[model samples]
Target: MFDTLPQHLELIVLTFLLAGLVKGVVGLGLPTVAVGLLGLVMPPMQAAAILVVPSTVTNVWQLAAGPRFLGLLKRLWGMLVGIVVGTLLVGWLLAGRNWPAATPLLGVALILYALLGLSNKRFRVAPRHERWLSPLIGVITGGVTAVTGVFVIPAVPFLQALGLEKDDLVQALGLSFTVSTLALAITLSQHGSLLQADVLGLSLLALLPALAGMYLGTWLRSRISPLAFRRCFFGGLLLLGADLAIRGL
Candidate 1:
């Protein structure tokens, strides 16, 4: 079954598997890992294109796992809107081109995210201020996502600061990421980056490995120490980010 796949297909499959495993264990990083690794060999836009389906599907599952979906949506509506608008604007600006220029920005983002994770920083937002802050962060996150295809920075940290319970935090992340993925899909489609027959087909094929890795990761989470594993994960991200930065520069 695997023999007929093109050589690049193997690399794509491996990338998804690794990314999916990270998401399964840590509840995030599919796009971060996928885009970071894939960017080494392909244009960042193409990497982003490949991430659309898998990111959407996995995040949908995450979003559906909790009961607070509606509540979170209500609170995050502004951010969601900002994300769509921001991504659309930036995507329009950079569409239909190799856009290798964006790789360094992506590299910086990955490194920053990893550093934050390693530092174990905590940010908190007061309930009274959430209304204004959510949209602000959303716009920033969306713009960054448009440029880099990774959606973790201000968004994840902002969500983390909300003081939500663990389950709610996870669900909220799912909601945010789901919106990001949808917005990215739309932007890519408009820019002509995601319309290729082969891109779409390969994206669908990559889902199998992504799902399998997720399952395996979930199982491993129970057996492994997540904190230790997270440290390693972040460390790896740091290296990947540095490599991308060096290559881009």
Candidate 2:
């Protein structure tokens, strides 16, 4: 059935565009913003499926725009692998018509994301301790991602804890998100969640708006401090999360 487009096509376009802008300015959050917003209308699994191409493309770009790929790979291999395993292991949560269960989980994930960003406390994981903690964080991140299509939970905080240089931290996030996107793709495919040709086409077309928004965001990032924007972003997300949570409950 080659339909013209998914329902609410305009909304979908805006979502990718806004999500890309956020990612460009913040250097992350494309999938988070996209999926979270999309969750308002679709299942997490469906939102995740639509997310695959854009997420992989943007994250790969972010990963390549940085230096020292091999070093980041070496340092984060355990967590990367853990993300794949955890995503695959828990994918069944979205394999069936489990939308009721996923919504609250997505809401909770958003709430946690807001809380962590709003707080000023910086959590640090010692160098030696990262060996064990990184994989654990990855696993937890994957599980949450599997259910909610959001991957920042534990993972971003853990990455921040490592104390990498600014550039290195940004690149590391790209690498981690790249893996997470690919893993979620596999899980969705395994469950036939991505079998629709129309959906795939829609996802591909979404990249145009996403890239355009990213370009705009990158320009804005160079001029603005983003402090106020960050607060607004998290605040809006917190309220959205709370609404979703109540609806889900």
Candidate 3:
């Protein structure tokens, strides 16, 4: 699906729009949607690279305008630690195997997570568990992010369960992406996928479309009901997962 040029660009644009809408409404999801959908068209590694710049740019904007410094400082310490461990582990896992298989696993995880969200039974992580679970979830987030650029699934659910407010979620998501991006970029560089020229060029090129999507999505978010948007997001995930599984088979 991602192999062809014209269609690939179209899909990229469409996914960007959808991702931004989800993020604008719920306060997070560009990577969750982009990775799940684009993974169908490209190898997971390429999918991760394609999303890295856009994710960074949007998160940077959010970090700059959305919250207080102490607030971010308070939540990120644990999440960052986990992301570091998970990113390193994922890098090791991808050392020599067929890296493409990561796409299918990503699809499976997204499908499962979308369903989890639909259940309406939030899994709360207590303050007592925060010390351990935060890092554990962070590692999971970082690892999944390194492999497929889809860390929001595990991390978001845990944070939501913790009952963080919208502003807090945005802050945490921004920081999480920031840390995960740095770690993944380092690993990708080690593997020779994140060259300086490639990063600079694509970063410049992908910025505008991502911002456009963010603004459009944010606008649309107000018109749609939260329940309706959740349904659409989950439905989209199911279709994307089915496509990935069937095509991979």
List ranges where model 1 is wrong by over 4 Å: 1-6
User: Candidate 2's residue-wise lDDT over 97-193, tens digit each?
Assistant: 5557788888888988988888856888998898998889889999988888899998998999888999999999999999999998888777654
Error of 3 at 149 (Å): 2.1
- Model 3, CA-based lDDT: 0.72
If both were scored by lDDT, which would come out higher, candidate 1 or candidate 3?
1
Q: Against the true structure, what is each candidate's TM-score?
A: 0.95, 0.95, 0.88
- Per-residue CA lDDT of model 1 for 90-187, tens digit only, reads 88887656666688888899999999999998988999999998888999999898888899978999999999999999999999999999998998
lDDT (tens digit, per residue) of candidate 3 on 124-236: 77788887778788888887777776776587777677777777767766777777777776776676544355544554565667788789777887788888888877787
Per lDDT, the best of the predicted structures is 1
- RMSD, one per candidate, in order: 2.8, 1.9, 2.6
Model 2: runs farther than 4 Å from truth? Answer: 1-5, 92-96
